[model samples]
Target: MVELRETRIQTRQRVQPDDTNNYGSAHGGMVMLWMDEAAAMSAIRFTGEWCVTAHVDGIDFRAPVPSGDTLYLDAYVYDAGRTSCKVRLRAYHEDPKTGSRTETTDSTFVFVAVDDNREPMPVTTLECSSEESEQLRAEAFAAFEE
Candidate 1:
């Protein structure tokens, strides 16, 4: 078994001019790319195998991240099947100097572990190592219930 906390991944990216859209906010596609990468990292960490994104559900963009803000992405595995891992992904925009953050987007991503031949392979069960990890897993399940 792999502990959920052990697979938790966080990444940061500074939103540069090139990462923005014409509206001067972070581009939706760019944000999705970042989310995918983070989610993949969580899945790979849990399974110890290459993982590919199978689905992204309800990608809600709640706010815009203006250029020059730091984008913080957090991801962790919440559930696992025989060959798939369900990851919860969230992105927040922070003022680099002040350190205030606002959630910009959130989504649930599913990834399938693959072998060297690219065939789906079984993954170990996920275990929550703490109350917080358990709470997060519950919240992820609740989000999908809606």
Candidate 2:
């Protein structure tokens, strides 16, 4: 069984020259890729099954991340259907020394669990017993409602 807390994933990546655009800022595509990976991990953790990204929405890029900054990605599964999990993904650009972060992007991704033959599979019901997970779940849901 996968609890709601286990579906919450946090990860980071260093912005290298290869990941940046002509302006020396991280390309939108690269940032989207990082968000996708983070959401994929959360979905796989929640379903314990092979999963693929079926849809994405609400991609809003608020800031640019210059090369040498750290890209912080956080994702969590806030809702699910019989076979699909909805994930909230957020990205931030961080100052390596100061640890201050600036919001860069926000989006939602839906991943569908798959069987051995790549057919959609049922997902276990998600639950959250701890206060932290519950709060995170609530805030994630509220963010999209805005």
Candidate 1: Cα lDDT at 17 = 98
How far in Å is the alpha carbon of 134 misplaced in model 2?
Answer: 1.5
Given candidate 1, what's the lDDT at residue 81? 94
- lDDT for model 1: 0.93
What TM-score, over all chains together, does every model reach?
0.96, 0.95
TM-score of decoy 1: 0.96
Say which candidate scores most in lDDT.
Answer: 1
Off by more than 4 A, model 1: none
Give the CA lDDT, 0 to 100, for residue 118 in model 2: 99
Worst 10 residues of 1 by lDDT: 137-146
Model 1, residue 92: distance off in Å is: 0.8
Q: Candidate 2 lDDT, tens digit per residue, 1-146?
A: 56788898999999999999999999989998989999999999999998999999878889999999999999989888999999989899999889999998888899999999999999998887889878978887888756
What do the candidate models score in CA lDDT, each in turn?
A: 0.93, 0.91
